[model samples]
Target: MAPQKAAQEFVGHKLLDREGNNVGRIEQIYFDDRTDKPTWVSVQTGMLGRRHSLVPLQGARVNEGDLMVPFDKERIKDAPDLDVDRHLSVEEENRLYRHYGVQVPGPRRGMQDQGDAQGRHAAGAAEETGMAGRATGEHGTDTRAANARAMNAEAADARTAEADTRSGRGRADAMADEDITMVRSEEQAHVGVESRESGRAHVRKSVDTEHFEQDVPVSHEEIHVERVPLTDEDRATAGNAQIGEEDEEIILHAERAVVAKETKPVEKVRISKEKVTDVQHVEGELRKEHVEVDREADHLTEDDYRGRRRPPAG
Candidate 1:
């Protein structure tokens, strides 16, 4: 593994093959979730229009200009795909290591000592160490040691907080500000009618009522119907017993003959309206604080009678 540098720095760096030929660029970087360290550098290498292959970063050399690896462009491009879900199984890791002649580092191997981790607390410890030495013991050496330990603990806390902020765990509190709303409306209709009659007075009464309500959409149509009536000659023949050539009769009622019919409007349909609205908001606040944990730090002062003070009551 390379030194801990920002992942963005190596995003577009060039990768070289063992035969001194130019490969492709670094398409992506893969990190080990358990240790929060980059474990693989997925280099894309191939010809102009062909499928690129992902080469692992294990045992790859970091030259001054670019990353150097034992396998050339062709071999790297032809390497079997790396399924991140099954990222280089133990056996596969070993086989690739042997094939490329690279040594894979052991797991994270955290800091060997708490004292060493003190360097990580730079931001937080700076706040408390400046307090008055009156809280310390008469012995300067003891006071200095306690101060140093307090600083280290503060620094560790700061580092942990920084990690949480970067990993998106610290934004949980801010997510509570989001708001939601719902609106609904409905309508109903009803009708009632009553009637009464009296037999002795010979009186009668009637009641009528009509009610309608709809939440449906409107539709329209056209309707037409054919109408016909008896002709003048037919009506006159029906009224008279005999008919003469000179006889003339006239029909008072108007009549129509059957012909093509075109319908314009056939039925009535209901119509309704509805309105909906949605509001979105990005709500949240992000905050972080450093909490110090001093494992080996204390203050001591002399009393008027006993040369040393006792511990504070819980």
Candidate 2:
């Protein structure tokens, strides 16, 4: 594409070096005073894009939505620092042209044309004044006076034109300087949770001894004796029986309470953990930047100062 088109489209786009390394973003483009074509571009570089550097657009190209210049990233960044607040002087432009190895633009066409017109007009006026002086008697004095006035008039007109040019250039420079931006920032609270050992829990077992009592029914054997008078049948039987000493014995069985010990698991015991979610209120003091308009005109309202309403009162 043409250099003028490229320059127009390069603003706010990413700028890359020949090696495809990103130098910065293109902030503004400058035109040559003679040809009025794109000559230089200001790139926002350094940390957070706080610094701006001027790079030549002589061999620059637009590639994939990026402005690619035929220079190294370091070279572009280290170029000579010049104020971007005013039109570049001839010496400054020459220095930059040398640094970037680009040819300087030729003399301005408008200036050349203006000079030619002024010369023609002066010649015609001088001729007319000479003719008028000769037609009369005072040729020398009248010619000298007419020439002096003509010179003074031309000088005044040149000064006026120069002042107007400077004024217009100053306005353009002010517009370019506005490209510098102010970033208002603020602090934010990033909340999150992490696992940490707040405390611990333990389960243990211990034994305790205690006395117990209960009632049980039991029985034992008892001995009893009885005596009676003998009859006739007993006397008859006694004739055949021999009287001799006799012995009797008996055995008894009874139940008694017995105590024994045994071990068995009656309940389950263990240690475990579970997550319990809860909402907690966190407090912090955050800092932020606030922008306010401080103008010299005390009569200007907020709307007027912001240019949203009428012009400033003063």
Clashes of each: 8, 0
Per-residue lDDT of model 1, residues 1-314, tens digit only: 54446654676888788876778787666665556666666665433423445566655677776777667677776565445344555666655555555676663234334445766554445544544243444465566757677777787799788998876754664566455344443322222222334233334547676675546444444354588898998788888556666765554443344345475976876655444455545444433444554667445434533544555669
TM-score of predicted structure 2: 0.36
Q: What is candidate 2's local distance difference test score?
A: 0.79
What C-alpha lDDT values do all the predictions have?
Answer: 0.59, 0.79
> Which 10-residue span in candidate 1 carries the lowest summed lDDT?
185-194
Candidate 1: Cα lDDT at 15: 79
Candidate 2 residue pairs in backbone clash? none
> Which residue pairs clash in candidate 1?
121-155, 218-271, 222-264, 222-265, 223-263, 223-264, 223-265, 224-263
In candidate 2, stretches whose alpha carbon ends up further than 4 angstroms from where it belongs are: 1-6, 108-314
